[model samples]
Target: MNYETFENRVLPVKNKLFRFAFRLLGSSEEAKDVVQEVMIKVWNGREQMATIENMEAWCMRITKNLSLDRLRSNQRRATDSLTEGFEIRQETLTPHERTEIHENMQRVNEMIAALPEKQRQVIHLRDVEGYSYNEICEILELDMNQVKVNLFRARTTVREKLVKINAYGL
Candidate 1:
């Protein structure tokens, strides 16, 4: 692909790709690095890319693999930070509101982190990244049924956890 065409076509997806990487890796800097690496790889393989049926799926697959490799190499559990990009303003909030928001966010993050790897990946692609089932299957190299099952399990697990947390006032 020509540089202009590649930029016009693929560049728009960078933010989405970066967000996917960030959600998976839980580090903004690492996510940015993954996006750069994935883009470079795509650029290098542009000739072969022409033969690929789904460029978005292909790019997502590359991003997921690279992010997983980075995670494995680091040997660290994923930890999401609300303070990923913009610094939290110290503007005072009512104590009640602050506590409620903090608790809810923490609960959500913990539930997501607690999900199984395949389930978490499916959730990230389907929910967070807004990918269709077919695209998610392509990115994850899983069959359609597997993708559906994992996504169902992931959402169900998260919903159950949230219900329990609410019932117990956690």
Candidate 2:
């Protein structure tokens, strides 16, 4: 319950919490605010913190709930969304090649974002964050079967969309 204990145990998961929050809320500022809120909430409830087994997961669950609450409070059907940016080596490829790659990456990102809500959340938690099924279940408050089914359906939808793009050159 002390500041030192909370710092030692819970502070380390800030980045993970930020990423999860950002993934849900899709704005860096909003995500940072959510992470701060999560930290404060955890600190306030520090007396009960030791009862939890996985501190990181617990923090993540709080981040998820807070992020979703923010979304609902805003009453926004859509978020600003995030793009996965990467550096270009500038070695073996021409500007045309780089542009093509960037376009493809953006297309893939749009496809994922277009997925249904539950599918997108499950995909992000499992694929992007690399959380286990049980952890995702806890975070999403879903059963194991529902998590797996959502993940499977999400993957299939992505694959099908990619195939359409590649096959039709669309």
The number of the candidate with the highest lDDT is 1
TM-score of every prediction relative to native? 0.87, 0.88
**lDDT (0 to 1) per candidate:** 0.85, 0.85
What TM-score number comes out for model 1? 0.87
Candidate 1 per-residue C-alpha lDDT over 60-162 given as tens digits, one digit per residue, 9 for 90 to 100: 8899999999999998877666443442245587777776677677668778877878898899888887888888989999999999999999999998887
Clashes of each: 0, 0
CA RMSD of all predictions: 2.8, 2.2
Write model 2 residue lDDT over 1-170, tens digit each, in one string. 78888888889889888877776777788889999999999988988987999888889889989999998898654345455446666769998999888788778877877877789889988888899999999988999999999999999999999899889998
Which residue pairs collide, candidate 2? none
